[model samples]
Target: MVNFTHQDQGTSASCWQQAGLEQIAALDPEKLFHAMASVIVLAAHPDDETLGAGGLIRMALGQGTDVHVIVCSFGEASHPDSTTHSAAQLAALRHAELAEAMDMLRAQGPRSGTLHLHCLGLDDGKLAAQQEPIRAALEQHAGERCLIASTYRGDGHPDHEILGLLAADCALAHNACHLEFPIWFWHWAQPDRQPSFRHWFRLALDASSTDAKARALEAHRSQTTPLSALPGDEVLLSEGFLQHFSRGAEIFRATWPGHRDAASAPAVFDELYGEREDPWEYRSSRYERRKQQILLACLPQERYAAVLELGCSIGVQSAELARRSTRLLAVDASATALAQARRAVAGMDHVELLQATVPRQFPQLEPGSLQLVVLSEMGYFLAADELEQVLAASAAALQAGGELVVCHWLHPIEGWPLDGEEVHRMAGQLGWERIVEHREADFLLEILRKPAGAHG
Candidate 1:
């Protein structure tokens, strides 16, 4: 998708300065040190905490707030092609570096508060499959009134996005304050083309905190400099990339308690539909018509006993699906969208329309009740874990030999963490047999069948 690497010449800090980053509202130090009982920092890799939230952690620790840094992976793959060191050796070296950096911060705090470091030893670049372990680590150290901070969701990196989503969910479950800091967002994102820039809080580092962060970043020698004069051990964080974090301020996206439910998908789509009748032009677009026909042609059978469509926006395709099913249940989150859908399929007693927020609140279905589950053009709306939950729910409802069809637009959806190809790839890993695979520049169509003898 976005072709960027640590070696690329990244956007300079001067460019960001010109973009008015200095104008973000300053984080209230009194409220942070007074209201929050503790701080829990999550890092997909070792240097993330140092890069994104080092100054904030130091300030919190100086105020006697308990601080915990949870590193999800050893980041062994960062230098995979190294000729000098093996992965195990690299892991050990990074572990020691992280500890040394923590000790440096612990001494700088001057409050004698607790500063702990945790390394989960998860594999690098594959955190999408390690959601359970990530959740367990967060639950083990999180406090009731703590602030849970992690990488920015939709940070253009899969590992960072996964950690962000998990941390947000953990914060929601435990009723903790959540903040998202950006590391890659700086290197990859142009200041103008960034994700929603609302609700950002700035922490202007004091002289002591700034010096402490500078020293801690240097402790990570393997990344700041190079491990050796070898081929693969070259410097990972280029000077230009590091400049983005070395600025004397930190920015965080704040999602407090009232904001934790994520503004509700229903409200989001309602705002879009209220502005216009068909935001996506599902009824008249030739592309939409062609995609629906292709999806209909990919079905394994001529007709189905029962069918379900996860996001039947405005019900144009729901009308087509109803024609091919004995019973059809079309679901959407927006009531406005569903009302239009209701009119599209009027007088069809077999077709039912229901409004629901999925993954967080999935509709109940009897076990082995569905003959077909059609998730056409909707899976990308969910984050990684949300998509997994939907897949699990579909698996529970589909009987043996029942089919699940996924068709999604191929391009990236703005403000979302996943794309169409990623959804299909993750769904294909559920151990079900994929009987049909079709790909086009605009979309992808996949059909997976539940295996024989597997219980619903």
Candidate 2:
């Protein structure tokens, strides 16, 4: 399962700003508030509303929309290990801060309801168990065509995910339009390489709205201020994380109603890669370049006869692998990426690029037919069963003593069912003798070899 501490200083907002985050799309004010008499904003914790949708709340209220703020928890567990304060103390403080924040936001606009704050008082870290309570709390606000904004269902936090999904469910049940506001996504997600870009949008916060959000966020001083000089009492939301919310606009995602179960992964990626030559900066990023160098150094042999590279994104590393193998078959799901890979390996007859998804479209692996298989920076995209299938196929394809390298980012991604550590853990269960194991703060790499005399 994915795990992380809030203390992790994450990706700087400058990277996102540089990636053209502001240029994606603008939410039309008319369409945003059209026919919606009420707006319900659900947050997993105390300050989530201020961080993710404070500007949205202000904007909705300013347009004569009655706003209801539902906070799932007081975020008491934020500093569970604090020596200076107990969980109960933190809960009271945070609850009060939330009330103050709500009051501050309410003061920003003339047209808003008095029944604004709805604190469920659920356990902070244990929200997954209280789904019924969360749903019931939202169900109380059931009405006609209310605009509901919840935390992103895949926002990488366990509590956030549960609240997001339940809020979406409630919206659907009431036939209300819903949106997802990402609180933790900005901290861990790579710039511009996330869920379908089409669903993303931003609301431009005027000076007044931006100032209101800042002041409302400031009201949550227990989160922003350190409890004491003691250890474990440090601020949870650091400057780097807060930077994500410091912008003049807040980002939100909207999904087409009634299509909850359908996701076009290939189409999402096609849009990602088609928009740019290098979406993740694989060719230019020093972090990525260093990672490739490390993976190259982990190769167990000087060369291999036949090799397969799965999820060979833009062929930056595919071209490198081409030189080490007599024949290289690189497979990717995105045709746009495959086209870029084609250019990266131009005129290299030894290299081949194919557009193929994993498991379903995964090429059959003839037992003991290949010398090497490289599964890099992928696998986490697959469901647990699908990843296991890919691993089993790679194991069957590799000849005795053949090497298989699996590498992936270590940070928590929005929708990954598994993390980098879990990927290596599952691969370790394959019983292959690990030849090389490398772990970095941001990524994980493992090179395992099929044992000699073991039937594939």
Candidate 3:
């Protein structure tokens, strides 16, 4: 099990002080609950839902709104040092604790009989590998005009982060509002240093609701106190940790509206290719042909050691890029596009094609290893925050003085959240030196060099 108790007491104290230095804006509970058709809570562990949003859940239920709770794990590995109990025994105890916690929450609400609960029973500490199954389960329960709540992605836990990403995707797919609550973030994150992209609001709880939340938290006996009589066993939820949650209100942040869903861009291309093999006419258009030549000619070096071509649809650009690169790895999200790309580049031994979704399943390149990267006609497919992540990844993988070339259409597509200019504007903010910028009536092309000694 991961040892969260090892966190330095001094640093935790500093974080707690910073957390309360500035008060977060208040969110009106009546306005929030009245607008939601339903609510879905995704908890990475047994007590996460209670620790983060217990009061919010009570208010929603008391208002007679339908609510669904999905607990992803039974938290079997939390007390790995215990000598009196096996992992199975700990898991069984955690399950019972969760049931009791839910009963305590429901007892405080008016419509206590209507809340639905699901225990996935997934193994603790391994949720990152099981994203697909968890995502499918969340999608089944999510619906339009609903509110989805999950732990914040930056909550300092692996399971919580992955589930937060999955919850954002599900919320976007169902057109629901996504709210993220902070759990461990309060123990480490400094309030003033939070990222500019994050917006936060606190759900104010009255004295009665605060007391109810405290009682609900007390139901998880295994976490709040010592779990076993073994010599090494200790309380997982220390007094320092519980102090962060003792406030009268709980803090919630927004995620999906600013971050694009992983499936949204891929789904658009999938449907477009379903109708025709070449949706953008990369093979036959004179404009595309000239654009490709301009992109190739703008390279600073005559030849690159290795190159990555993101969104290499049908290998049209990959075939030309392969000649200039000793080794080329081309990637796209659509399997249909990759099938054609595989056939198109079959004769080239130096080229490799892989199907991967961006900002999620990127190539694991060694730090500062890649010599060049090409992003062509694909930036608009991502949201502002998603594009930022891709840019950061590219910066991390690029060698010192490595080149990044971007070619995007000037106009906006009907369903895309970002336009070509917006994508280029965000890239400009990454502090890379602009080496070459070519503008045309139809498209915009730019080449940026990674500054020497810079890291992503």
Candidate that would win on TM-score: 3
lDDT of 2 by residue, 310-342 (tens): 989989999999999999999988888888889
**Candidate 2 positional error at 341, Å:** 37
User: Ranking under lDDT, best-scoring first?
Assistant: 1, 2, 3
Ranking by TM-score: 3, 1, 2
- Overall lDDT per candidate, in order of appearance: 0.83, 0.81, 0.80
Better of 1 and 3 by TM-score: 3
Best by lDDT: 1
Error of 3 at 267 (Å): 4.7
CA shift of 226, model 3, Å: 2.8
Measured against the true structure, the TM-scores of the candidates, in listed sequence, are 0.62, 0.59, 0.80
Q: Give the range of the ten consecutive residues with the poorest summed lDDT in model 1.
A: 256-265
- Relative to the true structure, candidate 2 reaches a TM of 0.59
